[model samples]
Target: MDDIQPADIRLMRNEGSLRDFLRLQMTNGKARNAPAKPPPPPQPSDHTPGAWPTGSRPPRPIPQAPPGAWEAALHRLHTDTQTGTRCECPGCDPTTGSHPDAA
Candidate 1:
C-alpha cells in the first residue's frame, strides 16, 4: 500500500473530493475504516475587543455624500434647461424648435 500522509487527506478535503477519495482509499486498503479527526477549533486572540476574530481590522464606515448633492444636481438641471436643450420626451424634440410647454 502506498504511504498516504495526513496532509494528503487534508488536501482531498480542501478540494471537496474527500468522500470519493476516502472510498477509493478504503477499497485500496490505504485508509482505515475509522472516521477522520475533525480540524481543531479556531484559537481566540487577545487583540482589540469587538474586532474581527481573524485579526483583520473592522471595516470603516462608508462616508456620506455631500449634503448639497441633490441641490447641485437640481442646479445643473436648471442650467441645462436654460441652454435650450429641450427635453427629448415624445413630443419635445429640440430639433423641431418647438417645446411642448411653450405657450
Candidate 2:
C-alpha cells in the first residue's frame, strides 16, 4: 500500500495546510522553551463527612416515583389490607366485617 503523502493529507482533513503547520511548529517551539506559569492553589472545600453545614441534611435525590421492591411490597400490604367493597372503616370489627384489618 502506498503511504499517503502530506500533500494529500492537507485541507481535505481540516489540517492546517503545510504553511499553517510550519508556523504552528515554530510558535510551539518558542512556547516550549518558556517557563510554564505556576499552577493555582486548590480551593478549600465545604465537604465534611457526617456533618452538614447550618444543620441541614444532604439533599435527597429527586423522587423518581419509580416503585422499587420495598415500595411494591408496601403497596401490596396496603392494598391487601384494604377491604374492597366491605367498607372497613374504624370502630368496625372483624366479626362485623366493616374493615378487614381495622383491629
Candidate 3:
C-alpha cells in the first residue's frame, strides 16, 4: 500500500467530488462525540430562601425631604427679584396717595 500525498487528498475534495462525503463524516463524528447541553439555569422559586414572591416586586424605600425645605424655598424666592416690578394699581400706586411700601 502507498501513502496518499496532500495533492491527491485535495484533488479528492474538489467540487462535486468526495467533499460531501468528507463533510458528512465530520458532521456525524461531531454529533456522536459532542457533549450534552448543560442543564437549564436555576430558576427563582417561591420555596427558595430569600427569594421574592412571584409576580411581586421588592418594596422601594420612600424618599424624605430635607428639614427647613419651606424656609429655604422662601429665601430663594425673596432673593430672586430679577422679575420684580412696582405695582401700578390704583390702590398700590405710591403717587396716588398710597405708600410705596403698600405695594
Candidate 4:
C-alpha cells in the first residue's frame, strides 16, 4: 500500500485489485529473466576476412609480376650482360649448367 503510487493506480485502471498489479510485475519479471535467443550461426560465404580455415595453412605469398614487363626486361638486360636472355638461374646464371659452388 505504501509502495503503491498514483501512477501505479493509473496503470491499474483504478479498478483492478492489488493482486492484478502483483501479477503484472511477476509477468514483467519473468519476461526479463527469459533466456535470450542464441545468435544465428555464421552464414556460408567466402572465408571470414583474414580468418584461416581449420586444418589449413595460411595462403602462400606468391610473387606477382608487376603491372608492366619493363622492370623485368630491364633486370634481365642489366644482370644477364653476358648471357643476354639466356640466364635461367641454376640453368645458366653464368652460362654454366652446374652450380657455381659445385665447380
Candidate 5:
C-alpha cells in the first residue's frame, strides 16, 4: 500500500476524451423529476380600488370638523392647561368627552 503503484492512479490526461467525460458526467447525475416551483407573490389590490369589493359597501367618509368653534376651544384649553392655567369649561370635554371604557 505504501509503494507508488501505477494502477492506483488513472493518469490518462484529457487525451481528446473531455467531451465524452463531460457528457457522461452530465447524463449520469440528472434530476429524475422537475423541481417544485414556489407559489407566486400576492398581487396588490386583490380587492379593487375606487369602488368597494363584492358584497361589501364602501366605507363612509369621516364627518368634517365644524368651521371654527370646537377645534379652537380644544386647542385653547390644551394651551391653557400646558401653561398651568385652569380649564375654562370647568367640566369634561364635551366634544370628545371621556367614557368609562375609553383607553
Candidate 6:
C-alpha cells in the first residue's frame, strides 16, 4: 500500500469552498469547544468621601489650634468669635475641649 504525501494536498482558496468548509465545521462542532466564561464581578464605586471602604480607620479633621502658638491661637479664637482680646469672655472657653464661642 502507498501513503498519501504532503505534495498531494492542495489548498482551496475560493470563497465558496472556504464557506462550505466553515459550514461543515459548524455543523459538526468546534475543533476545541471552549466553555463559556462567566462575566467579571462589578467593581465598587470609589466616590466615597473618606477611607471607610479601605478596611482602615478614616482620617481625623484638622485642628484649628497650632502647636506652640497658644497665645496667637487664643487671639484667633477671640477675634473669630468677635470677642475682645480677653480670654475671660462668657462665651469664649479656651480650655473647654470643645469648639470655642461658635454660637
On TM-score, the candidate that comes out on top is 3
Q: Once superposed on the true structure, which residue ranges of model 1 sit more than 4 Å away at CA?
A: 1-34, 41-55, 74-103
Q: In model 3, what are the clashing residue pairs, if there are any?
A: none
Clashes of each: 0, 2, 0, 0, 0, 0
Across 1-103, the per-residue lDDT of candidate 3 in tens digits comes to 1475877668877755677756877898899899999998877554566777677788989877799776545443342134374343333323233443545
Off by more than 4 A, model 4: 1-14, 46-103
Question: What digit string (tens of lDDT, one per residue) describes model 6 on residues 1-103?
Answer: 1453444323433334656655776765663476667998775776465447767776889877667588556545653344334555455545553334454
Pick by lDDT: 1 or 4, better one: 1
lDDT of 3 at 34: 96
User: What is candidate 5's TM-score against the reference?
Assistant: 0.29
* RMSD (Å) of each candidate, 1 decimal: 14.8, 13.8, 10.6, 14.0, 12.3, 14.4
| Candidate 4, lDDT over the whole model | 0.62
RMSD of 6: 14.4
lDDT of each: 0.63, 0.56, 0.59, 0.62, 0.54, 0.54
* Model 6: lDDT of residue 89: 49
lDDT for each residue of candidate 2 in 1-103, tens digit (9 for 90 to 100) = 1465776667535765767656777898899899999998764486565666656778889875664655444434433234344332444444323344444
lDDT of the structure predicted as candidate 5? 0.54
| Per-residue lDDT of candidate 4, residues 1-103 (tens digit) | 3487878878777676767778978898899899999998896576576777756887799888877565456435434544444444543333233434334
Model 5: lowest-lDDT 10 consecutive positions = 4-13
Runs in model 5 lying further than 4 Å from the true structure: 1-35, 38-52, 69-72, 75-83, 89-103
Which of 1 and 5 is the better model by lDDT?
1
